[model samples]
Target: MMTEPAQNTIIEQHINLDDVADLNDTNPLELLVQATGLSKQRVKDAMTKGAVWLSHGKQARPLRRKNARLRLGEELHLYYNEQVLSETVAKPELIADEGDYSVWNKPNGVWSQGSKWGDHCSISRLVEEHFDYNRQTYVVHRLDKAARGLLILAHNKEAAAALSAMFAKRTVEKHYLAWVNGQFPHDSITIDKPIDNKPAKSIVTLKEYDADKDRSLLSVQILTGRKHQIRIHLSSLGFPIIGDRLHGEPTQSQDLQLMAYKLDFQCPITGDKKAYQLKTWT
Candidate 1:
C-alpha cells in the first residue's frame, strides 16, 4: 500500500493486489475501502465520478465498477479529491433536442469534458445521466469552464464525427459576447496574432458601451478555435475581459463576462441549416 498525503489535496493511493495473497479475489471497492479508510458509499461515488483507476501493464484508465476483479499483478489507484467530489454544479438547460445531436446551455463552472478528477460536473456526463445512459453521449465541441453558453452534444458516434469535422474545418459560425473594461476604441477590429505558435484569428465589434460604468460590451467571432483565443486577443488590444483573471486585468467580480452566445451550422445528418442561441446576456 502506497499513500500520498492528503494535504487538503487529492489523496492518491496505489494498491498492489499481488502483495496481499489473501486479498487476491477481493473486489476493487473493498481494496480501496481498506486502503483509504473511506466508507464504501464514498468509494462507490468516487468510482462513478471517475476518480478510481486500474492498470495491468497497460495504461491506467478510469474504473467505475465495484465488482471488477483485480488480477494478481493488477494495480488499483484512487485519486481522492474531496473538494471536487463535494462541489455542486448547476444543471444545464436543454435548448433543443435534435434526434442526432442536442444543444445545451452549460452553466458557468461546468466543464466541457471530464478529467481524471471527476466527470459528474461535465456537460457530457450530465447528458449521459440525463438519458439514463440509454443513448451514447459524445462531446462534439467544448466551452471554457469559466465561460458558459450554448454547447453541442452528440448522441452517437456518427453525429460526433460529423459535427467535430465541421468545427475543425471552421464551417461552424460561432459568436461570443464579452464585457470589457473602459470604452472600446474601435467599432470593429480583427486580430490574427498567432497564439501558442498556432494561427488564430478573432474579430471583435463593439456591441454597446455603458458610459456610466465605463464598460463596453463586444461581440467576438473566432475563425480558429484556440485555447483562450478571445481573451488573449482582447487583452492585447488593451481592453481585457472584465473577469478574465488569467489574461485580463483584475476585477472585483470573479464571474467571467464571456459567453458563447450563438452557433450556426448546416446539420450534418439533415443537411439543413441549424442555429442555436442563448439570450443569457441579453
Candidate 2:
C-alpha cells in the first residue's frame, strides 16, 4: 500500500517537461533541495524511492542509480512527499549555423524552451548562449527533451519564420525510432490521426524484434508535427513506447528507446530539398 507524505510537508509543482533543461548539470538532489527548501537527505530519499518524473525515461527510484544521472537538455519532475517541482537544463555543446538554421541532437531529458525565472536550462537558452551577442535565435520546432532526436534551430527571424511556415504546411518529414512494449503487428503500419486541429500522419516500420521481451523496435516517420503525436498515436495503437511513464507503463530502466533519427525538408534559403539522418542507436 502507498502512503502519503505529511500534508503540510508536501510540495508539488506542475512543471512543463520542456523546462527541465535548466536543471541539467546540477545535482538532482541539490536541485530538489533548492526548489523545495528541504534537506538534502529528504530530497535524496524521495529520489531513491523513484519520486522523480523525467521527460523521456521511466519514473526514477530514490536511489541515485548511475543511470539516473541527469544530463543537459532534459526535463525533470520532482515530488517531495507529495509536493511537485520541475526543471529543465541546457546542453553544453549546442550550436547554431550561418545558413539561418542549426541542427542539434537533443538527448532525452531537456526542454526546448522554458518559463521565466531563467530557472531551467533549455535548448533556446543553449542557442541563446551560442548567439548571446545577437539574441536572434528561434526554435523552429521542438523535440520532447526525454525523446532524443535531431532538432533544427533558426539563427535569425527570417529563418525562424520560414521554418515555422514549413512546419505549419506539413512539408517536413520527420522520422523516429522507438522501442515499444509488445510484438509490433507487421513490417509497416501508417497512423493517420487528427492532432490538435491538424492532420497528422505517421509511417511505422519494424526494424528489430526481441522475442524474449515481446518488444519490437520501430522506425516512425511523421508527415506532420504535433505535440506528443507519435507517442500518443502509438500508445493509442496499443504499443506504447517503453519507459514512457506518461503514456505507457513504468519500467526499471531510465532511458526511453525513442530517437528522432531522421528529418527531411526543403531549405527555405537554398530552395533545395535537404535530408538529415541520425542513427544514434542503430
Candidate 3:
C-alpha cells in the first residue's frame, strides 16, 4: 500500500546565482531547470503557481510566468511546497457588484490574505480575477479562513480608504451566526471582555435550540472587532462553536461552525444604506 506524504514535509529553498555566465542567461525556465535539475513541466508548474520569484538588492516579488526573460544580475528564488500548492481553493459567490466596492459570500477555507507560496485561493485574488484584472483590488477588512460568509472588496483605492475608515470608526454593523456545541441561555447576553488588553464587546442572542444535538444556534453582533472576537467570546462562555479546533472542542463537522452571516452599513461612496445577508445558512 502507498502512503500519503505528511503536510509538513516540503521543499523550500532559495537558489542564488552570481556567476557571470549564469547571470547572462535570459530564460528563467531554462535557468531554473538547469540549476535545480527538475523536469521542465515541474519547473513550469511551479512558476505558474507563484512559487518562483525574482529579487534584486532588497526588493523581492513573486515571478509567476514561464518563458519570461530574466534580467542579468537578478536573483531567482523557488519555493516548492507540494502540499500548499496542491490544495483546492473553494469558490466564492459574488453577491453584489457596486463597481467601486463589491460584496461576496466567502466560503470557509477561502483565505482573505495571500501567502508567499501563492494566493490562488484567496478572496482578494479571486475578486481581481473576477474583474479580469482591469481594476485594482483592495482589502478593507478580513474574515477568518475557517469561518465563512459576507465580505467586501474595494475595487479602487478611494473606496478602499473610505470603507476601511468605516470599519475603523466602527460604523459598519457586522453580524455573525454560529452553531455552538452547548445550549446557551435563553436571555440575550452581552460579553464585554478585554481581548489582548483591548476592550471588546459582543452581543449574543439565541435563535434556536436543537434538543437532539444539544446545540444552540446563536446570532452574534460584535460591537468591537478583535481578532477572533466572536469565537473567543463564545468559547469563554463554555459554548464553543462546533468545529472550532483552535479554541473549542472537535466535532463531527470538520468545518468551523461560525459565519459572518450579515453586514449592514451606510455606503460611503453613494450615501445609501446597504444591507447584505447570505441567502442560505447551514
Candidate 4:
C-alpha cells in the first residue's frame, strides 16, 4: 500500500540489494518498494518513466524494465525530480507535422524528455499522452531545459535512427540566438575550443550590440554538438551569456537568454530538404 509522493520531494539515492534482503534473486520493483517505502505501483511508475538506474561496479545503465531481476551487490538508484511534480505544465507549440517526424517549439521550463517523476512535464510524454499511447516517441536530440526553441521528435524507431544519424554525421545545421554580457569586439568571430577533450567550433556573429546597457545579441552557429559547448566557448572568450548561472554571473531575470532559432536538415523519409525556424524567441 502506498500513497502519492509529496510534491516537493526530490529523491536520488542508491540502495544495495544485499543490505535490504537476503534473497538470492528478486526483482528491482520489489527492492525499490522496500528501499523507498513507496508503493509497488509508485515504484513501477518510476521505472516505466526512466527514473531508476542499475549500477554494479563501474557499469550503470537506465533501468526501464519493471520486472528486471537484481544481482547481489547491485545497486538500484532512484532519481525523482520535484519540479515536474507541480500542477503547472508547459505546452509545446507545434511548428510542423511531417508524417515521420514532427517539429515543435518547446517552451522554456519544459524538459525535452521526461525523467522518472517529471514525465508529465516534458514534450515527449505530452506527445504520447495526447496522440497515442501505442505510438512510440524517440528523442533525436535534446534542448536545454531553460532554453526555448525549435525541436524535432521522431514518431518511430526507423525515423529515429535515420534522424539521429543525420545529427551524428554533422549534416544538420543549428542556429541559436544568445544574449551576452558586455560588448564583443568582432562582428564575426569563430571560437574553436575543445569541450570535454572533443573539438567544438562555434561561429558568433554580432547581431545587435547595446553598449549603453553593456549587452550584446549574437547569432551563433555550432559546428559540433558538445555538451554546453556554446555557453562554455563564449564564457571562455570573456562574454558570458546573460542570465546563465552555470557559466556566468546570475541575473535577476533568471531566464537564460538563449534560443534554438533555426534548424536545417534533409528529411530522411522524403528525401527533401527541410528547414524549420521559430520567430517567437528571435
TM-score of each: 0.90, 0.64, 0.89, 0.74
Task: Compose the digit string of candidate 3's lDDT tens values, residues 223-265.
Answer: 9999999989998998888889888865445789888989999
In model 1, which residue pairs have backbone atoms overlapping below 3 Å? none
Which candidate do you rate higher for lDDT, 1 or 4? 1
- Candidate number of the best lDDT: 1
lDDT of all the models against the reference? 0.87, 0.69, 0.83, 0.81
Task: List runs of model 1 lying over 4 Å from the truth.
Answer: 1-9, 18-25
Write down the RMSD of candidate 1 (Cα, Å): 2.8
lDDT of 1 at 190: 90
Q: Where in model 4 is the C-alpha error above 4 Å?
A: 1-84, 132-134, 280-282
Model 3 has an lDDT value of 0.83
Candidate 1 lDDT, 1-282, residue by residue in tens? 545445446678898878866765678898888888777888899999989998888778789999986777778889899999887898888899998988998888999988878888999888888888888778888899999899999998899999899888899999999999799999899999999899999999999999999999999999999999998999898888888988875545668899999999998789999988887693
Candidate 1: residue 264 Cα off by (Å):
0.8
Candidate 1, after superposition: displacement of residue 226 in Å? 1.2
Better of 1 and 2 by lDDT: 1
lDDT of 4 by residue, 36-129 (tens): 7777776676676667888899987668787787788788898866454443567888888886888888878778877545466788877776
* Backbone clashes, candidate 1: 0
